[model samples]
Target: MKLIDLNPQGGIGANSIYLQIGDVNILIDSGLNPKQAGRLAMPDFSLIKDISLDLIIITHCHLDHIGSLPVIMRQHPNAKVVMTHSSKMILDRMLHNSANVMLRQKEENNIPDYPLFTHEEVDRCVPRFTGMEFLQPQKFKGKTDEVEIMMHHAGHVAGACAVELHHKDRHIFVTGDVLFENQRTLRGAQFPSGHFDTVIMETTRGTTERQVGKERVNEVSRLIASINDTINRGGSFLLPVFALGRMQEILSIIHDARKFGRLVKCPIYAAGMGMALADYFDEISRKYQHVQFNRNIIKELNIQPTARKLDAGKDLKQNALYIISSGMLVERTPSYTLASGLIGSDKNTIGFVGYCDPDTPGGQLLQAKQGEDFTFATANVTTKLQARVERFELSGHADREELAEFAIQTQARSVVLTHGDQAARDWFTKELESKMPGSKIIDPVPLKTYEL
Candidate 1:
C-alpha cells in the first residue's frame, strides 16, 4: 500500500490525497485553492488516471476537502462518490453557492479568469453521491479485490466523518478534522480503541496550545460582558462571524445568557445566512442533543433578524447588537459595509469570533499594528471604524494536549499528519515522537508518496 499527497503541500491550501493499493486507487479528497482558477493551474492526475479509481470518499463539506470534486468526477466519470447523508446535503448547497459566487464575480468584473465549472456540473455530480451512515462497514469492488471501509463520526460538522480502510492484512485510518471533546453542535471523535498499521491525522491546531474549556467559555462571557457594558453606556456591539459552526455556537451562548438574565435584552441582529443556520440548528436539535447545553432553550430562542437591510442608517446602528458573516471582512457581505460605517465611531464594538486569515481585513484589524488606522470598504465608500476590537478563544478544533492524548491512545504503528502548516505538523510530529516511543511519524511533502 502507498499514500500520496497530491496537492496542498505544507498545508497552505488546495488539499488532495490519494491512497493506492496495487491497481486499486482510492481518492480521499480533491480540493483546490481558490486562486488557482485565476492562474489556470490544474492538478496533475497522471498517477491515478491510469489506474481504476474504485472509490472517492469525502470527509466533510468544507471547500478545502471537497471543492474540486466536480471537476475530478468529470475527469474520472466512473468513480463512485461516497459521503454521509448530511454531508451530501450541505455539500450540494455549498457547491451551488460557490459556483454562483464564481459566476457572479465573473460577470461583475467581466473577467474570464474565474472558475471553470458551472452550475450544470454541480447538478450532475449530485446524483452520483452514495450516503454512508456512521460506523457501518461496506465493501467496494476494487481493481484487484474488494476493499472494506468504515465511516466514523469526526465531530467537525454535521455528518462529518473519518475513514477507515482495511485490505489484506493491513488497516489504515484517515482522520478528517476531528474534534477531541464535545463542542456546542457535535460529539467528539470516537474511534475504536485499537492498534492500526497506519494512521493519517489532521493537525490544523497542533502547534497552538488551546485555551481550557472553562477558560474559553469565560473568555466569551467576559467579552460579552464588555460589550454589554459598552451598550449600557449607550453603545452597540458588532461581531463578524462565520455563518456556520461558530455563529451557531455564539448564538447559543448569547441565548443561554439572556434566558438566565445574564445578558441585557437589547435587540441582537443576525445578518446573512447566520439566521438560517441558527434555524437549522434549532430544527436538528434532537439529532445533536449529545452536544447541546439545553435543547429546549435552542428550540425556544427567538433568532429573528433585527436588521433587515444593510443600509447602515444611524438609527439602526445606534440600537441593536449585530452579528454578521464573511467573518474575514471580505467583499459582498454586510459585515464589511457595517464595519466601514462603524469604524470611526467610539459608540460601537467589533468582536471577532473565530480564526481570521492574516491577509484578510478582519485579520489585519485583529493584529492592530502600532500607529495604523483600520479601514473598511462599503460599496465605493471607504470608512474608518474606531470601535474596540477583541478576540475570544472559541475555536472548534481540539487543543494540543487533546491531540497528543488521542494519538497516544490510538497506538498506531505509523502516523502521518496533514491539514496544518509545516510548523504545526513538525511540532506535533516531534512531540508525539518524544512522548510515545516506538511509533513512526511522517510528514509528507505535497504530492510526495510514502510506501508502507
Candidate 2:
C-alpha cells in the first residue's frame, strides 16, 4: 500500500491524502486553501487515473477537509463518496453557504476565481454520498478483491471519523483531526486498540501542550467572568469565534454558566453563520448524547441573526455580549466589522476563542502590542476602538501529551504525521521517537509517498 500527502501547511499545502492499495485507489479529505480558490480545480488524476478510485471517504464537513469534493467528483464521476449521515448534511449546508459567500465577495470586490463549482455541482455531488455508521465495517470489492473499511469516531466535529483500512493482510489507520480533549459540543476521540502496520496521524497542534483539560474550563469561565464584570459596568463583550465547533461550544458553556448563576443573565447574541450552526446543534443534540449541552439547554440558548453588511456598526453597539465568526477575522465578516467598530471603546472587550493564522489581520490584532490603536471603517465612518484583546486556550486538536498517549496506544509499527507546520511536526516527531523507541515516525512532505 502507498500513501501520498497532497497538502501541508505554511504554503506547503492543505489536507489531501491519496491511498492506493493494489487495484483500488481511495482519496481521503480533498482540501484547498480558501485564499487560493482557482487552484482548487480538479487534480491531475493521471497517476491514478488508469486505476479507478473505488471510494472517496470524507472525515468531516470542515472546508479544510471536504472543500474540493465538487472538483473531485466532477473529475471522477463514478467514485462513491462516503461519510457519516450527519457529516453529509452539514457538508451540504456548509458548501452551499460557502459558495454563496464566495460569490458575494467576488461580485462585491471584483475578485477573480470566485465560486469554483456551481450549486448544481454541489447537488450532483450530494447524491453520490453514502453515509456509514461509526464502528460498522464496510466491505468494498475492487476489480481484484475485497477491502475492509472501518470508521471510528474522531470527535473533532459532530460526525467526524478516523478511517481504518484493511487489505492484503495490511492494516492502516488514518487519523483525521482526532480530538483528545472533550469540549462542550463534542466528545473525545474513540480509539480502537490493536496493532497496525501503519498509522497516519494529524499534527495540527503538535508543537504546543494544549491547556490542561481542567485549566481550560477554568480559563474560559474566568474570561467570561471578566467580560461580565465589564458588562455590569455598562460595557459590551465581543467574542470572535469560528462558526463551527468553537462557536457552539462557547455558547453552550456560557448558557450553562448563566443558568447556574456563574455569570450574569445578560443578553448573549450569536452572530454570523454561528447562529445557523447553533440551531443545527440544537437539532442534532439528541443524537449525540456525549455533547456538552442537552437538548433542553441548547434549546434555550439565544441566537441573533448576523449583521448583513460590512457596515452594521449600529447593530453591534447595542448588544451586551456578542459572538461572531470568521474566527481569524481574515475576511470582512460581521465579526471583523463589529470588532473594528468597538475596539477603542473602553465600554467593550474583545476575546478570541480559536486558532488564528499569524499572517491574518485577526492574528495581528491578537498579538498587537499594548497601547496600540486600530482604525476601523464602518458605515462610512472611521472609528478607533481600543479595547482589551485576550485569547482562551480553547482548541479542538489534541496536545503533545495526548498525541503521545494515542500513539502509544495504537502500537503501530510505522507512524506518519500530517496537517501541521514544519516546526510542529518536527517537534512532535522527535517527542514521539524518544517516547516510543521501537516505533518509526515519518513526516511526509507534499506529494511524498511512503509504502507499508
Candidate 3:
C-alpha cells in the first residue's frame, strides 16, 4: 500500500490524500483551503489529476473537505463518488450556496476565480454521487486484487464519516475530521476498538491544549447564561454560525434551553442555508434511525427566517435572538451585515460561537475593544464596537486530549497527522511519540509519498 499527503502546507484547509491499495487508487478528500482563492484554494492536484481514480470518498460536505470536489470531478469524470445519504442532501444545498456566494464575490470583489466551479457542474456531479449508509461495506474488486471500504460516522457534521480500507494483510483507516464528544445535533464518532496498519488522523486542535479547569459542560453553561443575560437586558443577540454543523448545534441547544424554561422567549430568527439544512437533518433522523439527530428542531424553535437584507430590519427589536450564517462573518454575509448595524449600540451582544480564523472579519472583531472603531473590510462599513463581544468555544472538532485518546484507541502501527498548524502538529507529534512509543508517528511532507 502507498500513502501520500496532497495537502503539505496544511491547517485544516485543502485536505487530500492519495491511497493506493494494490492497483486501486482512491482519493480520501478533495478540499479547498478556506483561506485561499481560485486555484490557490485547491489541493495540489498536479500530483495525479490525470490519473483516473477508482473511487473518491467524501467524509462530509464542509467546504474545507468538499469545496474542491467539483474541480476534481470535472477532471476525473469516471471516478465513483461515495458519501453518506445525509451528506448528499447537505452537499446539494452547500455547493449550490457556494456557487451563489462565489458569484457574489466575483461581482463585488473582482475575483476571477470566484465561482471555481459553476452551479451547472455541481448539478451534473450529483447524479454520479453514490450515497451509502454507515457501516456498510463497499467493495472494489480489481482484476488482480480486492479492497473493501466502509464508511463510519465521524460525528463532525450531519453525515461525516471515516473510511476504513482493507486489502489483504494491510488495513488503513482515515479519520476524516473526527469528533469524539456528542454535540447538540450529532453524536461523537462511533469507530470501535480496533487495530490498523496505518491511521491517518486530523490534528486540527492538537496545538491548542485546552485551558486546564475549563470543561465543555461549563462552557455550555456559560454560553447559555450569557445568552440569557443578553436577552434579559433587552439587547439583541447575534450568533454568527457556520451553516452546516455549528448552526444546527447552536439551534438545538437554544431550543432545549427554551423548552426547559432556562431561556425566556424572545423572537428567534434563523437565516441562510442553515434553515434548509435543518429540514435535511430532520429527514435524516427519520430515515436513518442510527443518526443521533433532532427532528425539525428549527421548526420547533419558532425560528423565523431573516431577510436577505438583514441590516434593514436589524433595529434591535427588544430582546430578539438572531442566528445567521457565514460563521466567520465574511464580508457580505448576513451576520456581517447585521453585526455592522449593531456594533455601535451598547445594549447588543455579538456572540461568536465557533473558531474564527484571525484573518477573517469575525476573528479581527475578537481583538477589538469596546471603544475601538471597527470597519467591515468587505463593505467599508464602519462603526464603534460598543456592543458586548463574547466568544465561546463551540468548535465541532475534538480537543487535544480527545485526539490523543483516539490515537491510543486506534492502536495503528503508524499514524500521520494532518489538518493543523505547525505548533499543533508538533504538539501531537511529541505527545504521540511519548505515549505510543511502539508505533511510528510520521510528520508527512506535503505531496510526499510514504510507503507502507
Candidate 4:
C-alpha cells in the first residue's frame, strides 16, 4: 500500500490524503482552507487531477473537510461519493450555505473565483451519492482486489464516521474528525480496534488537553453557570457556535441545565444553518431510537431563532442566550453582528465554546484584555471589550489524552498523524512516544509522503 500526501502543506488546512492499495485509489477527504481565498483555498486538486479515483470517502460535512468536494466531483463524475445517511441529509444545506457565503464574499471583497463551485454544481452531484448505514460493510467493485468498506460511528456530528477498509489480509483505518466522549446529540465512536498495518487519524486537539481536572460533564456545568450568571444579571449572553455539532450540543446542554434547574431559565435563540441541521437531527434520532443522542433537543428547549442581522445599535433587549453560527464570529454571521452590539456591556458574556484560530476575530477577542479597543474588520465595527470572553472545553475533537489512548488501541505498526497544526502534532509525537513506544509514528511533513 502506498500512502500519498495530497495536502499542499499538510498543516491542518485543506486536508486530503490519497490512499492507493493494490489497484484502486481512494481520496479520503476533499477540503477547502478556511483561511485562504479563491483557488488557493482548495486542496491542490491539481495533485490528483490526472488520477482516476474509484471512491471518494468523506468523513463528515464540515466545510474544511467537505467544502471543496464538488470541485473534484466535476472532474471524476463517475466516482462514488460515500458518507453516512446523516451526513448525506446535511451535505446539501452545508454546500448551499457555503455557496451563499462565497457569493457574498465575491460581491463584498471582489474575490475572484470566490464561489469555487456553484449551487447548481452541488445539486448535480447528489444523485451519485451513496449514503450507507453505520457498520454495514459494502464491497467495493474495484479492478484488482477485493475491498470491503465500513463506516463506524465517529460520534463527532450527527452522521460523522471513521472509515475502515479491509483489503485482503490488511486493515486500514482513517479517522475523520473524531470525538471519543459522548456529547449531547451523539455517542462516542466505537471503533473496531485490532492489529493493523496503517492507521491514518486526526490530531486536531493534541496541542491542548481538555479542561484541567474536570470531566466533560463538569466542564459543561461550569459553562452553564457562566451562562446563568450573565442572564440573571440582565445581560444577553452570546454563544458563538459552529452550525453543526456545536450548535446541537450547546442547545442540549442549555436545555438540560434549565430542565433540571441547574441553570436559570432564560430565553434561548439559534440562527442560520444550525436550525436546518436540528431538523435533520430530530429526524435521525426519531428513526434510530437506539442512538444515544436525541435530535429533538432544540424543540424541547424552545430555542428561538434570532433575527439574521440585528439592526445597528439595537442590541438584545432581555436576558437571553443567543446562539449564532460562524463560531469564530466570521463577518456577515449573526454572531459577528451581535458581538459588535454587546462588546461594551460589562454584564454581557460572549462565550466561545470551541477552538478558534488565533488570527480570526473570535481568537483576537478571546486574547484581548478588558477595556481594550479592537476593530473587527469582518463586521466593519470597532468596540471596547468589557463583556466576559471565555472558552469552554466544549470541543468536537477528542483531547490529547483521548487521542493517545486511541492510538494505543489500534496497535498498528505505523500511525500516521494528519489534520493538526505544528504544536498539536509535536505534542502527539511526544505523547505517543511515551504511550506507544513499540510503534512507529509518522508525521507527514507538508508536501511530503511517507511510505508504510
Best by TM-score: 4
What would the TM-scores of all predictions be?
Answer: 0.88, 0.90, 0.93, 0.95
Q: How many collisions per candidate?
A: 7, 5, 2, 1
User: Which regions in candidate 2 have their CA more than 4 angstroms from the true location?
Assistant: 8-13, 40-51, 211-214, 288-302, 310-316, 373-385
* Residue lDDT tens for model 1, 1-452: 88888764357356678887655689997775543453233344666677667789998776667767887898889999999766765677777766876777788766586565778888998999998878889988775677888998787666678899888888888888777666666677776667788888888776677655646667767877977886886777888887666677777777767878888767667776656655555544545443453335434655446455665424355556777887778765778767766665677777886766555778777887433565554356544545677777666666667777777788888898888777788889889899778888988876677987
Q: What is the lDDT of candidate 4?
A: 0.82
Score residue 190 of candidate 1 by CA lDDT.
78
Rank candidates by TM-score, best first. Answer: 4, 3, 2, 1
Model 2 / residue 5 / CA error / Å: 1.3
How close is each model in CA RMSD to the real structure?
3.2, 2.9, 2.3, 1.9
Better of 2 and 4 by lDDT: 4
Taking the tens digit of each residue's C-alpha lDDT, what string does model 4 give over 133-166?
A: 8889998866877678999988778788999898
Candidate 3 per-residue lDDT, tens place, 41-136, comes to: 889888886667888999988888888889888888888888988888778678888788778878977888778989899999989988987898
TM-score of decoy 2? 0.90
Per-residue lDDT over 1-452 for candidate 2, one digit per residue giving the tens place of the 0 to 100 score: 78777663432234677888776788888776654545543233444556577789999877777776787777788888898766865788888876787788678767687777788888877889899878889988678877789988888778788999998888889888878668878888887886887888888776666554546778777777877886877778888887778778877778777788788766766676766776667666666554554445445755555446645344356647887787877556778777776776767788887767665667778877656655443234344545778777777777667777778777788898887777778887888898778988988766666786
lDDT agreement of model 2 with the native:
0.73
Worst 10 residues of 1 by lDDT: 34-43
